[model samples]
Target chain A: AQSVTQPDIHITVSEGASLELRCNYSYGATPYLFWYVQSPGQGLQLLLKYFSGDTLVQGIKGFEAEFKRSQSSFNLRKPSVHWSDAAEYFCARIDSGYSTLTFGKGTMLLVSP
Target chain B: DVKVTQSSRYLVKRTGEKVFLECVQDMDHENMFWYRQDPGLGLRLIYFSYDVKMKEKGDIPEGYSVSREKKERFSLILESASTNQTSMYLCASSGGQAYSNQPQHFGDGTRLSIL
Candidate 1:
């Protein structure tokens, strides 16, 4: 079974600092990776996705993720963190089949001023 | 923009009561999915429909059933609401097959509280 792992349970970064959210996947074949963000009391929103392309994938709100095959990781990054960027993040992976995705436990990002 | 709407933003029901959560999408997407969001569980898929009248079980379908009588509406039913079923329920839709991998658009979600 394909699985996604997000190592961090919680991360606190000061405003204006750079941010990186790590995601790892366990799969035998090609994998479709995605990052989603959820604000409190709201549904999950897609931040970015990596299907097949240049390893570096850009997403909304000044975020980008790089797919590294050697490391078995797809890490999300932002050059600078804003207070509004604080939210819970989830990493997901899907292999060609039923189209259902498996999600990680999620990492909570807390931005402080 | 894809428009996915849920029947309620928040619901409170007594335990053992039957609960129905409705979701509607205006995009006419062939694929509709229902997921439950818990504190640490992230989003667990409950059920999904690929086409009208077609349904499939997801990772966590034990307490739920689904209905897709119309192309735009998909409903999730809880045979008997339990306290453990109290969580945020999300609905998402995306095109099927040729557009299978498209990012799913989501609704605001319904927060259910089973007493």
Candidate 2:
């Protein structure tokens, strides 16, 4: 079964500081990775995705993730984060085709001034 | 922009009562899905519809049923609502190509409470 693990359950970061959220996925074949953000009382928005070709994938709102094949990790990173960046982040994976995706429990990001 | 709309933002129902949660998409997406969101559980798929009148049971579908009479609307039904079923229900839609892994666009979600 394809699964995703987000190590950090909660992370607190100061505003304008760099941010990185760790994600590990388990899949037999090539994996499609994705990052999504959810605001309180709102639906999820896609941050980025990794299919093939590029190891480094850029997403919306100044976010990027690198897909590491050997380590089975696709961590999201941002050089600088704003206070509005505080939200719950989820990492998901799916095998080839339009199948269902398995998501991590999510990491809550807290930004402080 | 794709817009997935759920009929209600919040709903309150009594135990053993029949409940219906409606979802509609404006993008004419061929794939519509229903998922329940809970703390620690993240999101669990309840049902999925690939096309009109075609439905598939997802990871968790024991307490729920679905209807997809039209291409743009998919409905989730609870035969007998239970307190355990109280959670945030989200609706999403995606383009249904065989090998395309398009991201699913989500709705605002419906928070259902069962008494």
Q: Which sections of candidate 1 miss by over 4 Å?
A: none
lDDT by residue (B1-115, candidate 1, tens digit) is: 8899999999999999999999999998999999998887788999988899999999899979999999999999999999999999999998866226767888999999999
- Number of clashing residue pairs, candidate 1: 0
Q: Which candidate ranks first by DockQ, i.e. highest?
A: 2
Residue A96, model 2: Cα distance from true site in angstroms: 1.3
Estimate every model's Cα lDDT from 0 to 1: 0.91, 0.92
The DockQ of each candidate is 0.57, 0.68
Worst window of 10 by summed lDDT in candidate 1 chain A: A93-102
The numbered model that scores best in TM-score is 2
Question: Residue B50 error for model 2, in Å?
Answer: 0.7
State the lDDT at A27 in candidate 2: 58
Quality of candidate 2's docking, in CAPRI categories?
Answer: medium
